[model samples]
Target: MWGGSGSGVDYDVMEVYHLPTGAWDQKPTTGTPPPGTWVYSSVAIGKDIYYFGGRGAGDSGYQYQNSLHCLNVDSFKWRELSPSSDYDPMKKGFCGIISVHFDGEHYLVIIGGLGSSSTPKQPNAQYNNSFGDLRCNEIHYYRISSDQWISPVVTGDRPPPINDFTLTPVTNNTAVMFGGETDNGVSNKLYMISFTETSVDILEVPNPGGSVQWPEGRWSHSSVLITTCSGPHLLVVGGDYAYDVWLLDINKRKWKELINLPNNVTRRYWHSLSVWSVTPTTNWIIEFGGLTEYTDTAVIELRYTSDIDWSTSVIPLDQYQDQLRRWILSDWENLGLSKEVQLLRGHLQDRKREFFEEQLQREIKEKEQIQQDRDKEQQQLLQEKATLSQQLDDATTLLEQAEKDKSSLELEYNEKLNAKVAEILEEKTQVEEKKQIITEDYEKLKLKVAHMEEQYLKEKHIIIDDNQNLKSDISEKDKVIAKLTSQVEEQSQNEKQIITDLKEKDLHIAKLVKERQERVLKQPIKETSSIGLQFNYLEEQLQTKNSKQDTPFSRFLILIYLLFISFVLSTNYNSKQFIGKI
Candidate 1:
């Protein structure tokens, strides 16, 4: 019995049929029970049915229930087990729990599941960020006798935290875990987890590519282990967005997807799948419950035979159909195996034998075909090997010739490189010497200009003072008019001599400036060089002064200064450009 919609208020009751009395009884627990929830893990061990974690009724955090309860099938009584103090029930739910009997003791094994947190049931909106956390990967074992939860030491390539996976026990010590949802996305990887007395080891099964097309990635699928005459294999059923069935061959470690099944079988998730029969004659995988486009209450069956083949048969009855519904409500004895059905079974057995014979013959033919193909491939390989050997010898001869050519070219390149380096070094030495000479001349010119500026300022001050004295001595100036005239003439002669000397000095400066300009013009401007930067600064200064107020004398001085600077700049620019050509 389980709870469904309407806030989980409606609990669906199960009908149990008594085999001997041929009577049906509606069974529902009367005592206090676990909360109504979804996605819970349950397993039946002997007469007790155990239930674990799932989504409970409420909102957000209150929605995940962590209760563990067991119902007695014989007495219809519910009992809750109290784990040790170290074990917390709230965090114990929502894991893939299974009961396995080993060494005469039953132990409940729990695999990965959703942790104690709240998340959106369906994260449809793009902006919804409600993914919680995944539970631990360590396998948790609960001892039924001791009532203790023990986490065994697990080693090997531990799988990432995942949930909604199907873990079916293949044997007492081995179990196979199929696809599950992870933080990254849905996974289709399969692993074989082996349990021992002290430790657990998990090994990933490789899906080597071959003729068989593997199943696509999915979660919330159903898988159950079944033993066949060939070997043990897992029968996987429908999952989210899937209606196809696949079989995982344990011995071969490969997948073979089932096709051509009845059309009524559709994709399902949160469905129950189990091994319905383990008889040698016919084995069956039964699927029930879960949603497919909407709520589904259909029971489906898959029949397997010793010939290692699968077929689906419709039971012709469902949970809702009243007519022929007694087929589901009663045991096999109540609706005894009719003679017609028995005859059909016998016919199936005959067909099964015929299938095995045909299959055997097919295998022999396939083997012979494979052998012939292999021999043909071997002959082709030998011929190719001989052809490759001849080609390799030719390549070796060509390689030697290429090596000789490379050595000659390398020698020629080295010689050219050495000559270029020597030429560059000689040029560098000449440039350094020229730089020293230019720097010395520049220093001399700078000192001379400073001296001239100082002398000009002193002479201007003295002239102004002399004019003021003449104005104050006007009366004396008239009485000594004759003496003043002679003094003026002498002063005029001295002024003329000074002017002549100044002109000669200016001419000397102009000559030196012209020579430097000629040298500068021989080279191109080196934009990043120190001399280039100085030239730019001087040009700016000349421009600024020319733009400001100026007298006739100052203007003439500016003109000469600008001419000298411009000539020098032109020379440097030409020199640098010429050097680049070299």
Candidate 2:
């Protein structure tokens, strides 16, 4: 067991299971080890094992590796092989690859895997951003000798894009593929791939024919080509979550169930399987680490040990010295067979004939049963054909009668159709006339609406202009009123000035009268009359001026008071009457 992952860890290390010692030892790798070897394909060619694409460790920050690395078993060294052509199969995981030889050159033929949209995809498959994550069905091969990557013009019935499948090579040019995940889901269908000098082909294979149960369709399963004296059988071990085992007799194309390890082996997927042949007859089909239901330490001696996580073991288990290994050795019981049939034979060359004879009888019986089924199918088909022929004959007669009826109907239809056409034409003419009249009416309405809108606009403008003119007239009347009020205020101020002058004049007249009287007393009584006359003239002049100033000023004051009746009284008033009231 080399590189695979399950439970919780990806096994980038190697472990050696010694048949003689019946123990497992963690084989310390010397050179550059794979960064992330999760679900990668590592095929042994000669002494070197070539590891190819698979998922990287999420915690370690690795990406799906597209680089090819080789680990030499003898040197325990790793060397990375760089391909010349940098093309499709962009960093991918869960890919299937097998080493094949063509014309003396060793090549690695690869198939489907899961990748992102950045990776190259088969042009035939439809993809959308909704499921930008893609799976590959394109044929990619690396020429090992030349260190070159090549994509051959693939022809034939190619399988749909898939991931996590097994490709157990059956021949130099052909490899049998079992279950994998496709767009449709996990599949159990089988396919055969044929590799040539310049191209690859795929052909879908029918599942093994038998009354016995077939293995459940699953992905990330393990399958190995277990060759026997009877024939070559594909030993398919635990897959996904099932611990059920099955064998496919390649020659017979039949499936046979092995004893299930539901109680013993932890059901797993993403695991590894290898065969340890101790002798020509003694063999061990060793299964290694994978996903299981529990944090199971490797089972041994039927002891339940959970002290360590053995999921990382290539052949999973955990025990002393951090040794991750759990070797489940059940010899013939594991094989679900006896020592003779299990190939753990002891000088029993005679049993080979017995096994072969038993196989021969089974084959003969299967063939006879298949032949009977074929005969039955043929009989059904013949019966169906005869029934179909009778139906066709009846249909032909009905068709002939229908054709006669069709001719008569066509003739009658033509007469009716002509009359209908004439009536339609007359109706069409009437409709046209009506349409024309309606169109004319519509035009008239449109014009009338436009004219009404125009008149409304004109009236609106006229009203606005007249309202503005009225406002202007009101402004002019207000200006006139202000001018008149200003004039009345000036007149009132003039009246106040004239009244002040009259008071001063009266004081001066009184002073003159007093002086004249003093002079008369000094000059005797004879000049008294003359002085009095003068004083009287002075009084009359003063009286006449006072009368002119006092003519109806009170009435004018009343008019001013009436005009200011609605206004608040101002403090500037000097009139005696107004002041006294205040």
Best candidate according to TM-score: 1
Report each candidate's C-alpha RMSD, comma-separated, in the order given: 36.6, 25.3
TM-score of each: 0.50, 0.48
lDDT of each: 0.66, 0.66
Query: What is the C-alpha lDDT profile of model 2 across 1-582, one tens digit per residue?
Result: 556544543254566675433466666576666654676677888998888876666555655767688888877778878531235556667778898889888999888777656555555543332155567676778898788878787777788778888999988777888898887878888777788878887787665556655777888888887654455567777677456667776766667666624433437777677765432223355555677654343322211112211111122333321221112223334446555443444333354467568769978999999999999999999999999999999999999999999999999999999999999999999999999999999999999999999999999999999999999999999999999999999999998996886577546645764675566567753553464465457556645655665657644643443344212222222346343543
Give lDDT for model 1: 0.66
Candidate 1 residue lDDT tens string, 126-164: 111126553545376778898776667787767776778
Give candidate 2 misplaced runs (Cα > 4 Å). Answer: 1-13, 57-62, 83-86, 122-132, 207-213, 279-282, 294-582
Candidate 1, run of 10 with poorest lDDT: 121-130
- Candidate 1 residue 270 C-alpha distance from true site, Å: 1.3
